[model samples]
Target: MTVLILSVFVLVYLGMAIGRFPGLQIDRTGIALLGAVILALAGAIPGEALATAIDYPTLFILLGLMILSAQFELAGFYGWCAVRLAQAALSPVALLALVVAVGGGLSAVLANDVVVFAMTPLLCAGLVARGLDARPYLIALAGAANAGSAATIIGNPQNILIGQLGHLDFWPFLAACAVPAVLAMVCVFATVAFIWRGRLELADASPLPLSPPDLDLWHLKKALLATLVLLVFFATPLPQEEGVLAVAAAMLISRRFASRRMLGLVDWHLLVLFAALFVVTAALARTGLPAAMVATLANSGWAPDRLSVLAPLSLVASNTIGNVPAVLLLMQVWPSPPEGALYALAVLSTLSGNLLLLGSLANLIVVERAAASGVTLGFWEHAKCGVPMTLSSIALAIGWLWAMGHVGW
Candidate 1:
């Protein structure tokens, strides 16, 4: 049973890292689900224990946020923001800052992937229309989204998982991560705008003029109201999952977007992936091998309870297998991690994705979207900003967290 659980866990995570089997059509989500099924069939995890293994709060919080984002996407609010940012009466450098500002800021509140998806084309089109190169702005878009999403527990999926699993509150988590997030965004803008200074000026006007998506003002208003109410609830003693679920329910009650369509937009695959990971991880934990291994490693100064250990470890792991998987792996092994260590792990894992184009989903979305739209933002072009962005941002995050006396090596 132990070997079977370990084997299933290993194979599933391998699929997660590679994103697919060599010849199989399965994705990370499918691989995770498969692992859980294998465990169940083998009796590694029993009936009642199955439900206990999954983190329902995290899954529901993620679901509600995705639905809220979908409503805004359908209403064209993100498009409206991007177009408005694009037309700002600012110079290239200033405009890039504004672009980063908006991308990063909104990502703290909404799903960065959705924000990037809506903003990319409009941003690229608007900038390209003015004869400025879109590559740098695109890079900044990716980096800023990663950084900004670090500011809050709800910003991205990994942080959401960390927050839910850690039982982190909204305001306190924000206070812990906001400074590093802000500094990272600044670093993102500086690296891109400075490196691509000349190119940010006129290249050639876009051969194709593009218009932003039309805004459904009514739905937009509805989402904004619901969001504000959610925020107020977040400030209160209310649970994030419950508040977000209520908000999502309110949005679904709308006549403009059908419930099925809106729910369809939610990343159910990701929620399933989370649930599957939890089950497989719980099965792994029952083997006692993890706790023993973690105990042995703690003496070697690699325990996740140690901030110095978790930070760099998280940075490397996050980039290696992606942030979500890294967090899940840590969850399986790390027992009763300190709040400081968890916060550090969450923020560092998120911000470190700025290191590579494939590092984060937000970055990937921006790159793929740019490619399909005829702009060629290649590796080097992205790395020019990404490498520096990662280094500077991580440094800033560590420094800020240290200064604020959160935790430091």
Candidate 2:
């Protein structure tokens, strides 16, 4: 049973590393689900244990946010924002800054994936209508969303999981991460703008047509109100997870939107991924491999006591298996890292997503949307901005963390 669990864990991570089995139909989520089943079937973990390993608070939060985002999408809120921003007639630099600012700001409040999903089409359409090169704006959108999400506990899945698991406070975590997130956004704007400066000119001066359609005012109002209430709750002394769940329930009960539609928008696959990882990691933890590995590193004078080593490792691990899973694995070994190491880990892991096209889901969405719209944003093109953006943002985070003495090492 132990060998079976370990093998399943290895195969799952390997699939994550390679993204998929060559010529086979499998993805990270599928691989993770399979691993969980294998572990259960092999008697490494019982079904009840597997169920217990799943973090319902985090899952509920993600589900609720997705529903809220879907409601906004149905109301055409994202389209409206994009059109308004694009119509400002700003210069290329100003437009780039606006994209990053809006994308980042929204992402800090809403789910990063939802923000990217809604923003991508609008951005692509707006740029195409303006006859402007969409690559820089698209890349900035992806990078900004990922970076912006680092600011708050509920901003992204990884942050949500980290906050829930680490018991990090909402406002304090934001305070710790806000500066770096802002700096990262600025860096994202500058990097993309600088690289694509010459390509920002509009080839056509035609104004894009906006046809008014029937708006779902009630649904939009309900989602907006629930979101605002959730924010207020987060800002208060209430239990974070419970408050979020309450807001979600209120939204779910409202007749303004169908519960079925809202529920369907939830990313069950992502939740499954987290649950499976929890079980697999739990099995690995049972083997005491993490302690042994940490011991080996400690003996070699490579302990996580140094921010220099810790920060870079966090970045690399994040880009490798994504920020959420990376945080889960790292937290197991270094449960209570330095005072602000958790926040630093959240920020760096998110910012590191810009290092490569495949570094994060947000980047992949942008690339896929671009491809569908006859605009190709290959990995190399993305890396041109991703590499620099990632490096600069990470450097800024490390400097801030060190200067503030947030991390003793």
TM-score of each: 0.95, 0.95
CA lDDT of each prediction against the hidden true structure: 0.85, 0.81
Q: Tell me the tens digit of each residue's lDDT in model 1 across 1-409.
A: 8889889988988887788899889988899999999898889999899989888888888888999999998898888887777677677889899988999999999988889987888887777677777888899988999899999888999998888777777889999999899999999999997888677775554343656678998999899988898788667777778989999988998766789888877778778888999998899999999999998998887777655776677777766678888898787678888888778887899998888776787888898888887888887888888888898888888887777777757
* Candidate 2 residue pairs in backbone clash: 307-409
Q: Given candidate 2, what's the lDDT at residue 249?
A: 81
lDDT of 2 by residue, 296-357 (tens): 98799887756777778877877787777787777766646665778777887888888998
Ten residues in sequence with the least summed lDDT for candidate 1: 202-211
